[model samples]
Target: MNIHFIAIGGSAMHNLALALHKKGYTITGSDDAIFEPSKSRLEAKGLLPKEFGWFTNNINSNLDAIILGMHAKPDNPELLKAQELGLKIYSYPEFLYEQSKDKTRVVIGGSHGKTTITSMILHVMNYHEIAVDYMVGAQLEGFDTMVHLTSENEFIVLEGDEYLSSPIDRRPKFHLYKPNIALLSGIAWDHINVFPTYENYVKQFSIFVNSLTNGGIMVYNEEDAEVKKVVEQATSSIKKYPYSTPNFKIVDGITFINTSFGEMPLEFFGKHNLQNMVGAKWICLHMGVGEDEFYEAISSFKGASKRLEKIAENNNSVVFKDFAHSPSKVKATTTAVKNQYSNRKLLACLELHTYSSLNTEFLKEYKGALNSADTAVVFYSPKALEIKRLEKISEEQIKNAFEQDDLIVYTNATEFKEFLFTQNFENSVLLLMSSGNYGGLDFTKFKDLM
Candidate 1:
């Protein structure tokens, strides 16, 4: 197959491009700018563009398909050229559906925890040498690429994101995959820039549930009322398997899940993660993995990248960085860290870089999100908000929204980094959460900061 990508340097887009290249498809792509990791990986695979900017010549009638990434606008030059040629254009998720339409798609979708849940299933499957094509948002330890596609695999596990499919397609990405097996972890209002109202934000999940194939399997988090409501309300003929946080004991900082086979010790700890494990277990069971195999394989699972990932640890202090920017994720991550290290002084820092986190109205949803942190610090760049053309935010607003009187706030990255360096690490757990780069912050320097 001959395929060309528009804006191919994205995290997901680059991974898909690499997967197709490995599949022996003739691939070409263009991106305005390419960052590290993506650039290096694509260059290594010989899929990197010859130049930085889009070229109209890149889109020709000979192309079999044009995979449009979210990074590319509807009026993008190359996109227009492809449209002029009457070529088949597929959104990232649309193309994924096209690739795995014949297989039984097991999609994991929710406001948070989607990446971790997808990673767990893939890890267990990989451990048992189960042959399946898959696409997960975060990179797993043994996986070479975030996406893997094969013609023979009977199943494909996908991390179904609820974000917009493309600039032109207003539908949620998860809705594109008519999954034969699906899981919805929890529902929380997010993507305020795309879905303005809370009802509108949640309706996307409802639509996703309704889109599942007839007589499919749905594994959901019954502990979350919103998720339960969505699943119960769906009129589909799917067999529902609801799961909650399994009974677990955290002994000496290690977590163990009490399973039917016995207790399984895990490298990661958190109530939310335990809940995710049960959900993943249900999906794996439906995919033909035995209960014993699931428990044995999951014991070796640490966690997905940037999902409560441990970065550095010393005698008295441990540091973790998470990709938590939404209110629910921030609260869940902060509460998880605090619950795990109850005796330690918890210092949690969150960077509000996303449009929803920076929005004035959406700030109220964050009420008490950082309350579990003994020391709470909130940081956001005014320059970033300006770039998004969002309304300016102030430290007072952040403090009022979080309802933390002693909350430390910083708009400057230098001051935030300096404050971090000056903090006392005596018997403390430090957590850094954000989806952004924290304003050119070099995380490697903090490896030995403890």
Candidate 2:
């Protein structure tokens, strides 16, 4: 198979390129710029273009398929060339569906927890020596590539993202999966630039639910009222399975799960994580994994990268970094850390990096989201707002939006870093949340201080 990629330097796109390259496909890709990790990884596989930027010559008639990334503009030169040649063009998700049409697709979808839940399922499957193809959003501990595809694997686990599939593909990426077994972690409005309103954002998930294959099973979070309502109204042909926070206890700041095999300790924690585990458990069960086997395998599951990932820790303090920019994710993550380490003072700092999180209209949803923290700090960059073409937001607006009169808000990364460095770390936990690097601040430098 001959596969070409546009905007190949993207996290997901590069992974997909490597996966296909490893699968014996003749792969080629182009990007205006390639950053570290993606650049080195692609170079190692001989998939990186010799020069940055799209070239019309790269899009040829011999290519069997062209996979487009979200980073590519609609008028991208290579994309236009491919269209002009009447070649087959597929969004990343669409191409994934084309490859796994015969396999039992297990798509994990929701506003949050999808990556963690998908990672758990993949971890258990790998532990049990069960072979399955997958396309996860985040990098897993043992997986070399985030995407895997093969003719032999009977199932494919997909981290179903609700965002637009491509620059030209308006459909939500999850809608293309048509899963035989699906899981919805929860629904929280996001992607304000695309969906605009909360109701419109939610409607995307409803459409995703309706797209499931006939007789498919949907494992959803019962604790989320919005999730419950969506699952209940889903097509009757699909089987509904609802899950909530499982029985678990935290002892000495460590979380343990209550299972039939006895109390199994975990390397991860938080009520939200526990809830995600329950949904993953149900999905595993449906995939023919027994409760005992699931528990045994999940015991060693550390966690997905950047989802409540422990960057550094010591006797006096611990530091975590999470990909939590949305209002609901911010709240859940803040609450989780506070609940997990009730004995310690919590210093939660969040970056308003995403378009939704930085939007003037969407900022209101974040009211009291960080109230659990002993000290809450919100950071945003005026440069970021300009790049995203969003309305200007002030520190006062952010402070007022959170409804925390005493909330500390910073528009400058230097100021934020200075504030962080001056904080007293004794007997405290620092939770740093954002989808982007906090204005290129080096997180590793602060790791030792923890």
Candidate 3:
């Protein structure tokens, strides 16, 4: 197959390009801009565009398909040319569905825990030497690329993102994956820019559930009320399996799962993670993996890239970085860290990076989200708000929104770094929470102080 990509420098787009390239497809792509990791990886694979910018000339009759990324605008020249040629054009998700139409699709979807749950399932499958094509949001330890596609693999595991597929395609990416087996971890309203209202945000998931293949299985988190409601109202033809936090205990700062086989010590900790594990187990079971085998494989599962990832640690303190920008994720992550190390003083630092988190109207949802931490610090860059063309928010606004009297807000990265450096690390845990880089603050330089 000959494929061309529009705005292919995206995280998922680059990975898809690389995956197709490996599949012996002639692949070419163009983008306005490409960032690190994506740029380097694409360059290494010889898939990177020689020059960055779209060329209408690149789209012609020879191309079999054009996969569009969200980065492309509606008037993107290449996209217009492709349309004029009457060539097959698909949003990334649509193309994925086309490729996996013959395979059993297992899609893991939720506002949170989707990546971790998908990673766990992939980890167990790899441990069992189960070869299956897969596409996960985050990079795993052993996986070379986030996306894998093959003609032989009977099943394909997909991390179902609810974000818009492409600028031209208004449907949520998850909606395109008509899964044979699906999992919804939980629901928390997000992507305020696209959905606008909480009700509208939730409607997307409902649509996703409705899109599942007939007689498909849905594994959901019973503890999540919204998810429970959605699953209950789902068509009776779809089999529903619910899971929650399994029996587990934290002993001496280590989390152990109480399974029928025995107490299994895990490299990863936290209640959210425990819940994710249960969901993963149910999915694995559907794929013919026994409880004992799943547990054994999961025992060594460290974690995904940035979900409570331990960046640096010592006897006195441990520093973690998480991709937690949403209010619900912040609360859950903070509570999880504190619960794991009860003896330590938790210093939770969060960056208000996303459009939802930075919006004044959406700020109120963050009330008491960081209450689990002994000291809560919220950081937001004014430049970020300006770039988003949002009304300026004061430090007071953030403090009031969180409804935590003890919360400290900062707009300056250097000052935040200094404040962090002054804190005594003894018996304390630092949790850096943000989807952004916290204004490019170097956490490594301050690790020694901690």
What is the overall TM-score of model 1 with all chains considered together?
Answer: 0.99
Worst 10 residues of 2 by lDDT: 441-450
Tell me the whole-model lDDT of each prediction, alpha carbons only.
Answer: 0.92, 0.92, 0.93
Compute the lDDT of residue 386 as modeled in candidate 1: 94
Residues 1-450 of candidate 3: C-alpha lDDT, one tens digit per residue:
999999989999999999999999999999999998999999998988999899998999999999999999999999999999999999999999999999999999999999999999999999999999999989999999999999989999999999998988899999999999999999999999999998998989988888889999999999999999988898647999999988889899999878877788999988888999999999999999999999999999999998899988888789999999899999999999999999999999999998999899999999999999999999999999999999999988998999998889999988988898888888889999999987888868755665
Off by over 4 Å in 2: none
Per-residue CA lDDT of model 2 for 1-450, tens digit only, reads 898999999999999999888889999999999998999999998888999988999988999999999999999999999999999999999999998999999999999999999999999999999999999988888889999999889999999999999999999999999999999999998888899888998898998888888888999999999999998998648999989998888888999877887788999989999999989999999999998999999999899999999998998799999998888999999999998999999999999998888889889999999999999999989999999898899888998899999899888888889999988899999999999888888989877686
Candidate 2 local Cα displacement, residue 98, angstroms:
0.9
Clash totals in order: 0, 0, 0
TM-score of 2: 0.98
